[model samples]
Target: MPIVMDVDALMEFLRREFPQVSEDFVIEEVTEELTTVRLAVGERHLRPGGTVSGPTMFALADVGIYLAILARLGPVALAVTTNCSIDFLRKPASGRDLVSKTRILKLGRVLVVGDVLIYSEGDDRPVARASLTYSIPPRA
Candidate 1:
């Protein structure tokens, strides 16, 4: 499917719809097949061990897939996650941003399925993986 929203449009949508965490996320790249997003790590995203927290990584994956869906479907704020499974494969590097690459596995009329792989900035190994299903809201 072609992308209806590019990186700039996605970033604008995030800032308009979700101002609270919009600044933390950067829509790095958006293509027909994949979308890449970056999370600007801050002190709040770190655990006691000075590594990125699981919840933080999950948030990146979630947002990454969400943006990927929106890129193909346009600004569907009502589209919401129906299912999510995440695995923390390895500990994220300290004092670095997190990057997620997301691609849609299936794009149906009612549901969208996708997966995201997250890596610490400058690292080759993925720190986490997530599979997500989103329910697209019915159009009136």
Candidate 2:
């Protein structure tokens, strides 16, 4: 299927619907099978050891998959995450923005499963990997 939402449109939809988190994420690219996003790493995203926090990484994965699903389904604001499994493989580079490379494993009427690999910006190795399942809201 063709992508219903492009990066610019998806960014607008996110800003309009979820302003609180809109600025935290930047949509880099969007396609039917893949989506790329960046997290603007800041002071709040770090932990006591000066490394990126786990929750921040998890947030990136979640948002990446969410946007991937939305790319195919349009501005379906009601889609929600139902399950996630994440592995933290390495420490993220300090003060560098993180990138999430996401792809869909399955897209269904009520659910979409996505896999994500996260890396520090400019780094070649992944810092974490995640598998997420989102429950798409039923159409009216």
Off by over 4 Å in 2: none
Q: Which candidate is the best by TM-score?
A: 1
Which candidate comes out best when scored by lDDT? 1
Ten-residue segment with the worst summed lDDT in candidate 1?
Answer: 46-55
Instruction: Assess every candidate by TM-score.
Output: 0.98, 0.97
lDDT tens readout by residue for model 1, 8-111: 99999999999999999999999998899999999999988898988899899999999999999899999999999999999988889999999999999999
**So what's the TM-score on candidate 2?**
0.97
Q: List ranges where model 1 is wrong by over 4 Å.
A: none
lDDT of 2 by residue, 38-83 (tens): 9999999999999999999999999999889888988888899999
Q: Count the backbone clashes (under 3 Å) in each candidate.
A: 0, 0
lDDT of 1 at 51: 89
